[model samples]
Target: MMLEDLYRLLRSGHVQAQGVVDTITQPIIVLDQNLCVVTANNAFIKTFKADRDDIQGRVFFELGNGQWDIESLRQLIGGIIPRAAAVIGYEVKHDFPVIGQRTFLVDARRLVHPDDNSANILVLFEDVTERQRHDAEMDFIVSETRHRMKNLFAVVRSIAMQTETKGRTAADYRDTFLGRLDVTLRAQEISVSNTPADFEALLRQSVNPLGAERFHCTGPSVQLSNSRIMPVSMIFHELATNAAKYGALSGQDGEVHVTWSLEDGPRGRVFLRCEWREENGPAVTMPEHKGYGTELIQATCAHVGGMVELKFHPEGLNAVIKFPV
Candidate 1:
């Protein structure tokens, strides 16, 4: 007879069932026609903390000191089977004496026994409490970020309104507002990407589009919060704009020295310091009038629990900013 005529499910008694059962990663529970545990995989034993001798011939629910009496979970799994299109899973809270309470993702499927018209169930699970918690936290962050951005826009509008009323002329107000927006945008650039980058790389990237070729920057490496890149970028943008207009960057020999390092950590205090200095510029002086850019730089630094020190010496303009680590 052709080999295709033979039954695959009716394995010979010599066939090693234990060898196959131990190889699966997903927890597998094979129940006999009576819905009694016939066998379980190593993965299943580890997951349920029940020994093979203890679980065999016993009902799955009553196997582990009745600890697996997760009602909704059993119902969800009781409905699924092999090649079945249903996506069934449940979260079960297990409170072991020493381990406290934890949530696990239990997924189950039923399979038709090839030899008999009976059925078997296989359950797989992983602890997903931490994952769920993290997802919730991330969602909160996203909502908070949107809220903060809207508030910031409102603040920008207020600055625009005040500057329009206070400026000497309409053109003066227009120039001031445009500069203000650019600074604001630059300060927020680093947060635009989800990736982490060193401080100097971030600053260099922030300054590039704003006529960076006309300027030079030097700095050492320092760790930085990914979200803080944007505000700092704006600060640098304002500083760069000022230099291009009236400071060292306006001159051929003008250069910007940007460096940073960590200081001794104080008790319960976390801080990092960064300095950006301008060189070979004409004499500098404070502006006769306050504008949005100046206010933005000060406010942004302060918001980050830090202060920005601005120095206008004959050589150039320099700024030192400290922020919470």
Candidate 2:
């Protein structure tokens, strides 16, 4: 009678828990209320680097730490039951012995038995390190694109305004617009499609027309990826044009100095700041009327979460920009 009862229990389908675990796409792991491993699917076995016989009863946190180290995984899994909330897409990285690289998105669900509310918890693991990285890379590209186009708009507006107020005739304004656009394009190309922008490269190009002898550059390894290049390029254009027209480039002996630095602010965040100062130039003054270029600079700088300041002294002009890197 006892053997028949046991046989009937095993054949009733209730004893075969593995069937449910085997169907999931994500790695599924189930543990009793004490957090001891009860069952793990093949996906789970492969993800955690365990054989069916070895991992059936082991703790969840034995995986080495760093990128996908199991200690973090344990904490994440252990909390799901207590917190009674589903955790989704938590990113982790690990260097596993069996696998050269491990990056995973972990998900967990607090499982309760229908007959016994406190029996066990279910955890799901999804490998999505590649997807997360791709998303971040795409985000950087999009941000860079938006920033660069905004600067182009500003540059065009500035050219239009400058021509409208001072041009001798329609053709003169048209030609000047075209010339300014050409200069802007050089920077725009670097902003939009260009993967990276060098501070020195922009300065060199801006001052190239006047001659390399007229422009000087100073900075460390400052490279802004596409996301930040757009505004930086616009600021470059403004300062370079101003120096050429009114500051050092305006005179034969004029000199312009450009430098950059990175600083750590409150709460350990890094930022970029650039300074432009002129030597041997006329006094600077705020324009009585704001021009299109001025508006463009101000608006675009603010749009990209940056601040711009322009100063005119008896000696020449100085512009400073500070922004998130």
Candidate 3:
């Protein structure tokens, strides 16, 4: 039924008026011109955990130890309603006892008795706390996605600039740059996925394409935190790329052994130590000068508070990587 119909029933002193008001699902209260509670529906009493005897004659602002004495509510009812005669969806946030924090959309209307020229205000409260929380979470996700995209673009630019073109054909340069770019993007993807990236999974992603037979990997289960995943993944990628080009994976019957363990560090801190050993490839010799791949590997390791030690042995190459967990 409409507000007008309820007003008429209340004015006519119909016994069923209270029943009709109670039938409404939304919490509602009727107040006199002086802002004293005239009547409250079942929803209002149940919602606020109040009694009929305590509510009927009390001032709206003084109800329940003045929990309802909100300044915004006072201004809306005392100041705004007089001029507007009606207000719809006026928002109010309050921390209520028993219910904790809550947000409400308040709708109010001033109903006047035609014959007697007396007035009563009808107020309705709609709860929207959960909806607001969901909206806030969505906003955070959007902002985080934008930030990741910008970082990804910056990383790609760095890779393109640092990749060497000297003494290489166009196709060779293209392949090298694209390979690094692919590794960076893959790291980004794993970092953002619902499941967190782990040490073994990242290693497999970096080197499995070269053929699983080329590498034997064994390590204790270690979970990578979000900030550490990208750098650690990139480190593995660069190492694998180098192995494929000049170390174990480049020659038939060659193999790489990958293993890692967690160790206790100074001040009770924990660290991860990983070993990558290549064997049966071409005899190892130190490069005359540092290359971009070596620099990239070092940079990525340092990005995550880590370090790498590369050794050129007669059999092959061995790298020892250490980083904080």
lDDT-wise, the better of 1 and 2 is 2
| Deviation from native of the Cα of residue 76 in model 1, angstroms | 23
- State the local distance difference test value for candidate 3: 0.84
* lDDT (Cα, 0-100) at 291 in candidate 3: 69
What is the C-alpha lDDT profile of model 2 across 118-213, one tens digit per residue? 657777788876787799999999999899789768868876775544525777557546756776677666765757777677667756766478
Model 2 weakest lDDT span, ten residues long: 60-69
Residue pairs with backbone overlap in model 3: none
How high is the lDDT of residue 8 in model 1? 48
Give the deviation of candidate 3 from the true structure as CA RMSD: 5.2
* Model 2 clashes, total count: 7
Best by lDDT: 3
Model 3: runs farther than 4 Å from truth? 1-20, 79-84, 112-116, 189-201, 217-228, 259-275, 283-289, 313-315
- Give candidate 2 regions above 4 Å deviation: 1-172, 191-194, 265-269
Tally clashes: model 1.
9
Angstrom error at residue 226, model 3? 4.9
lDDT of each: 0.68, 0.69, 0.84
